[model samples]
Target: MLLSLFTVLLWGQQKETQEQLERRKQQILIEIKSVQQLLQNERTKERNILAEIEEQNRKINLSRQLIKNVQQQITITNASIKKNQKEADELQAELYKLKEDYAATILKTYKSRSNQSRIMFILSSDNFLQAYKRIQYLKQYADFRKEQGQEVKAKSEELSKALVRLEEQRESQKKLLAEQQQNEKNLQKDLDQQKGLMAIVQKDQKKYNDQIKKKQDETKAIDRKIQQLIREAIEEANRKAREAAAKAGKETTKSVGSGKNATFELTPEGKIVANSFKANMGKLPWPVEKGYISLPYGDQPHPVQTHLTIHNSGVEITTEGGSKARSVFQGEVLQVQVMPGGNKAVLIQHGDYITVYQNLSEVYVKKGDAVALKQSIGTIAANSTGKTVLKFLLSHNTDINNPQLWLSRSN
Candidate 1:
């Protein structure tokens, strides 16, 4: 009984794990499909080789992940199949023993089948007390026979169910194996496509390198401008705080620090908002409803040009065209930065922390506008390559942080 309970608990855990894997696989597939659509859109327009390659690289990575997920599922299925087979065998053995015992009991009862024989056996007792004891023995024997029959029936049914379950598990394993094979084929196709793209990229290394460098320079300029804006916002907030303290005739020196240090002197309300934002780290929602991180934060090697290093102050999330950017938390809009390309960026202040949503074609909220969590701030602009990417940045005062670290994993 203990072994059965343990097996049940083990199966429950494994089943839950399998379910989680399946859900993850589905999510990956959905993302792959979304990326595929973006690639198709890119194809419809003038070809931007670098952009195409990047999208292709993203798809290839997703394909590899999908294949890995399928492989894990197959592994789990195989284990379940093996476990079920062992269980079926054990049930069969137990059922066989039950039948054997039940047959013996039936045979013994058959030998004294007549009611008269049972009565005579009880009458043959020498005294009244002996006869009573003999009758009680007969009654117990009958009850034992009945219970043995029921036990045999129950064991038979249990064995049948086990066998059925074993067969089902075997079938499931077969289906999983087939699914794995198909995923491998799809992955191979993606890899082949990636190789071809890499070959094309290698043929004109200098041109692509120059293009990458130019883009990197533009990004660096934007990042610098963003940092300057954040510093200015911090200074402005601190300036206001100092003035308020001075007007109230309070000690401004202790209440508000110098803005040169790149920190905000928080008011009681500001402190609450800042504390709340800090407390919800890693629990913040994505700025876009449907998107994935195309580029991560900090310095990293370029996707195609591994020799070249790329620095990103924030994560670039690629989403469907025309998708609106939203605020991850409640905050007041600090600035609306308009870039040279006519695109805009909205900077929101949650106390000392600032969240920047860049690459927006249109802004919904202006400076000093109070915004709620998940409020639509602007529509993300699609680049020449037809890819709508949002450059999302997070900072505490003037200190940069990885937005990916703050955003919820479910995104």
Candidate 2:
């Protein structure tokens, strides 16, 4: 029983640690929401609703994970409790045996004779050998009785402590289970909020449909330009024979993955930025001062229809009204395009690393203009209906990134 109780106590400590992690996830979203909501009120931006919906989805996911963890813990805890009860039962039986033995020993010792009678009987021996033998026998009997009584007392004390420990374990399990239920309720609340936001977004669907179509066309154009850049790079590498022909025409064969991009023609600046991003994987700066992304980078479920899917090339961050989009690293502004959705977009080259900042109302830097890390390129679009989210993207030439994984976790 004691062992089982100790196991349960250890399990509860583990669950509490898991709960703390889940709580931290929730706290991050809440803080982000608090900042972005204030921006949404100031801007007439349509993308704010998108940001809100995405955050709600994140919270809901975390809550679901928490429920799964709690359920698992409950199963483990119940098994432990059953084992402990069995142990307690065995201990109680042992306790009863100890009591019976203790009582019988005392009855035999006391009922045998009065204290003076035992002494007198031993002293009345006829010789020295007889006296020594009688005294030894009496000591043996008395020692046996005292030992039995101590065993009974120890058993009772152990049983009491075990019971207390078991109760404490049970209480801990109950508390965790209750917290899990509360998380479910909170998830439901988030779902309702998302539904409301969806309604508002859908209401403006027709109004923004043409705008979306235009944006899509612009995005395709950008893709074509990127393809052109890649072709040019390949051609340039092929022409440079002194460069290693076996490895994309670079002087040195090198690695290009994640934030690192370029086989040939990697500028010194590109190498630095890639190295920095790698070194600071969990401490990269936020793209915007205060914003939340509505659209994420990847294939995602449509908010209105569960069966429908939407593919995005990059994540969209909604910043507050009149907030500016900033460069994440030192780079030359490659091009400034009139993007779809009636906003502006800027592309920057950091060695081989590239970043795209979209949904801007004005452009602060021009093509060929060198920009430093966190330098303002353009103000994020105002008149955003919900929240001002900055759609931040990182690229190693062409491959898209999951910004969530790349950026540092906000504390």
Candidate 3:
């Protein structure tokens, strides 16, 4: 009974492990595909070495992640194989013991085998009642022996099945190991490619540095303007909300303090939207249908220029050239502003929450236009450097949030 319970628990664990492995595998595949798209976009550029380096770095990181996930699967498979082997061993032992017990029962039955001798023994009883009692005892003994034989047969069949299952699990483990090895090889290849890219970057350090500096300046300027726009939008929304509240005879308190940096007091409807958006954190769809986050939000060391740290208020997605930037949620377009280099940005309001999509070539929605979830707002602009990058930002009132934290990880 203990062995049976152990087997049941182990099977449950194996099922759960398989599910976890499947989920990890799916995520890794999505990441690999996204990086491949980014690399494809980079290939179209005319000798932009920095872009190539960034793309290769992203690929290497993703490949490493894939290898890590494969290794984890292999680990899980190994554990399952061990558990299966242990269960098979336990079953085999139980079957052997059962066979031994059945052998002793058969020996005892052989000693009383002859039916004619048994009938004579019963006939030698003193009376009819005694003879009947002897017959009943003999019948019960025979039935007991038959039941023991059946049990032995059932145990043997069970042992055979356990052995077969153990063998299959071993085969599965072998396959998982082979897959992990292949992933490791792929990771090494990406690492080699990254090293080569790094060499090229080191040789052209000055030129690359200048180009990155220019790009950083442009990003900073754009971020400043976007933040300013968000501030203005918040103030405007607050003013309207307060007016609405006053007209409705509700006491309006400033949710955000008055000044350059102020938050918005939402109306009842806006509050609902804000709460809904907040609840969907880390579940929002990607701004682009297909892309990988090449540059993550906040401060980080450059992939090539380790000496320089780059501050990004939002994440930059490397996507296909013609891909359109989409709204991650149902929101109204706050404004569409053109940057210094003719790149357009669309800011969308989800109550107190706001999302900005930058580096767009054209706008599809005007200010105050309501947009649905996953609605395409504009086409992603391919910059003069031939890189199609989308800068995505998220904010709640005056505070900036990392877009990476909100966007779907698999998407």
Candidate 4:
């Protein structure tokens, strides 16, 4: 009984692990498709070496990621193959033992009954009760022999199935290995292309450096403006909460957090939204339905020049052209400001949290409008340079949090 329970538990764990791996594999495949689309989109327009390098960089990153995922799947298949092989061996051993027991039972039964018919055996008894007992013994002996034969047949069938399963797992492993190899080749090609581009870029180092500096300055300005907007939104939210509490004859508590960063004191309705939003951390949908993260949040060294660093207030997502940006959660639109580059940005107030979606070409939701989750706010701008990138920011009062941490895993 203990062995049976252990087997059941072990099987359950294995099944769960396989399910998780399968989910991961599916997500990676979706990411691969999304990246492929972006690459194709980039290729359609006029060619620029910088753009080409960026495209190759993204492609290589995705290819390496794909290879890693395939490697994980291969590991799982290998484990399954080993497990099946062990099961097959055990079943084979069981079949052998069962067959031997069955043969011995048959031989003993034949020896006992070789010279006696049922009627004769019964007649040999001393009295009526004794004859009846003898008849029952004969019936039971025959039943035991039949059961032994059935056991042998069942064990043999189980062994055959186990062997078949082992073979299937091996085949799956082989396919995964081939896939990994192909991804590796693609990754190497992209790497080589990136290296050639880097050489060209280094030759015109001053020109590229000036461009990088200009872009960095632009990013800092945008981030500063966004943070300013977020602060104002937070103050507005706090003022309303205080007014509401005063009307209800309740005291408004001070905001939480330390230093310059503080979360606003929420009203009853606002508190509900805040709680719900907090609960959905790392589970909220992306602003775009499908995309890949091109520029991640925070300060990092530039891809080409390690000496130069880049600062990003939020994550930059690359998506297909003509795609619309959607609100990740239900919120009241605070402001829809037009930035310096003619790019539009939408700020949505979700309790004490503020979400900003920038780089929009057109605005659909105006200030003071209540938007539902996943509602289209505006269309993302497709740049003349053949890039469609959306800048997404998440802030709690004055403090900026990485949007990637709040958003769901990309697939």
Candidate 5:
């Protein structure tokens, strides 16, 4: 009864541990889901959620797998215990027989225990060879009995250990199974949150598209402006390079970077602006925090009317309810224009690179003011029907580039 009560107590403790592990797993799942929601957030503040979600998912899977292993172990352990019990019972019967046989031998020896009786028993062997054989047999029988006793003792020890091992396995199964259950619940919750976000996005698609289109127009305007500047800059660079080649032909072999002539054209302020942008390439941040790139640089389908195609000078990152447009790199603000339907756009110029932030509801920087990387140019506007978005662009003179290639991926 004491042993039964102890086993029950052990199981209860195991169950409690399992419950605690389950709760912990659930907590991680909840965290992962929360991160997923952040990725869907329109404001997209620090979208570090994706990595968190992925990492949590890996752990959840591992936990589930471990639970499965524990369950299998429980089954195997139970089977082994039953087999051990049966073998132990057989060993006990054999042990009893060995004891009885040993007792009978001793009893007979004692009953006939006289020196004359022993000699007569030996003489009954009838030949010297038979007597020698009887002595050898007696020694062998004693050794066999000792070995049987050792076998029974070893079997009992093995059975005891096996039972303990089975209990441990059973406890593990309970604990891990509880953890898996908790993880599953957490996963369900996350799924529900994501579903809610997706529904919201779908419901606001029309408003989002209108906002995106207005921003796209603003981006195009900036592209044209940047292109004109690039052409002038390129022409100036070319003319200076020619002059430098004529004046410093012998020294052309002295420099390895871009032609020195291209360096002399920019005024002090312009040089500073250009240099600042050049130093931060591959380091610029994204314009908005949340959203997957739906339409990248080059040609793309109209988000509102898929059958009607349009060329995109930049990428469109579609995100949830609210987001702001920010500078991707440091530069002088060239212009901020308010478009029809309440959206605004900002353009910033670096030496050779130009960045544009569109779909804003308001402007923060005026033309000629320096804007730093990730500085909010303005809150993005809600398009017709009221949904928020940011359209972002990167370009060199007239050439449009995929923003995915320019902005630091770490952002």
Candidate 6:
């Protein structure tokens, strides 16, 4: 009985693990589909080789992940199959033993089946007390036979169920194996396409390198401007606070320094907002509703040019064309920056923390406008390549942070 309980618990855990894996695999597949659709849309427009390569790379990565997930599922199914097979064998053996013992009991009863034999056996007792004891013993023996028969029936049913489970597991393993094969085939195709694109890129490495360098320079300029704006915003907020304190006839609060060392001197209300934003770290909504991170934060090697490193102050999320950028949290709009390329950005202040939504074609909320969570702030501009990408940045005072860390995982 203990062994059976342990087996049940083990099966339950494995089943749960399998279910989790299946859900993850399905999610990956959905993401792959989304990426493919984006890639198709890009193809309909003028080709941007770099953007195409990035999209392809994303699809390849998802494919590899799907393959890995399926492999894990196959591993689990194999283990389950093996376990069930062992259990079924054990049940068969137990059933065989039960049948053997029950047959022996039946044979013994058959030899004493005559009513006279049973009556005589009880009558032949040396005294009335002995006869009564004999009758009780016969009754107990009959009860034992009935219980043995019942146990045999139960064992037979258990064995049948085990066999059925074993067969089902085998079928599931077969299906998983087929699915894994298809995923491998698709992955191979993706690799082949990637190789073709890489070959084309290798021929004109210098041109692509120059493009990457130009883009990097633009990014650096943007980052510098963003930092400057954040510092200015900080100084402005602090200046207002100082004036308010002076009017109230209180001693002027000490300045919080300048540049990278700048910090917000929060008021009582500002402190609450700052604290709330900080407390909700990693639980904030995504800046966009239906998008995926095309580029992550920090310095990483370029996807096409591995020799070149790219620095990102924040993440870039690629979404459907014409998708509106939304606020991740409730905050007051601090600035509306119009870049050199005519693209606009909305900077929102949640106390000392600021979130920037860049690459906007239009802005809905102006400077000082109060925005609620998930409020549509602006429309993300689609580039000539037909790709709509949002450059999202997060900062505490003037210090930059990885926005991906603050955004929820579902994004």
Best of the candidates, TM-score = 1
C-alpha lDDT values of all predictions: 0.87, 0.66, 0.83, 0.82, 0.59, 0.89
TM-score of each: 0.93, 0.56, 0.89, 0.90, 0.40, 0.90
Error of 5 at 221 (Å): 9.1
lDDT of 2: 0.66
Output the lDDT of residue 280, model 1.
95
User: Residue 274 CA error for candidate 2 (Å)?
Assistant: 5.2
Candidate 5: list runs displaced more than 4 Å.
Answer: 1-282, 300-310, 319-322
Comparing 2 and 5 by lDDT, which wins?
A: 2
Compared with the true structure, what per-residue lDDT tens digits does model 4 show for residues 116-167? 5777889989999999999899889889888888888888888888888788
Per-residue lDDT for 26-50 in model 5, tens only?
Answer: 5544434443553444244443222
Question: When superposed on Cα atoms, how far off is each prediction in RMSD?
Answer: 2.3, 7.5, 2.8, 2.7, 14.6, 2.7
Candidates sorted by lDDT, best first: 6, 1, 3, 4, 2, 5
- lDDT tens digits by residue: candidate 6, 345-389: 889999889999999999999988999999999999985456899
Assess candidate 3 and give its TM-score to the true structure.
Answer: 0.89
lDDT: the better of candidates 1 and 3: 1
Instruction: Output the lDDT of residue 155, model 6.
Output: 99
Error of 3 at 163 (Å): 2.6
Clashing residue pairs, backbone N/CA/C < 3 A, model 1: none
| CA displacement after TM-score superposition, residue 42 of candidate 6 (Å) | 2.0
Instruction: Looking at model 1, report the run of 10 residues with the lowest lDDT sum.
Output: 251-260
The TM-score-based order of candidates, best leading, equals 1, 4, 6, 3, 2, 5
lDDT of 1 by residue, 106-165 (tens): 898898899999899988899999999999998998899899888888888888888888
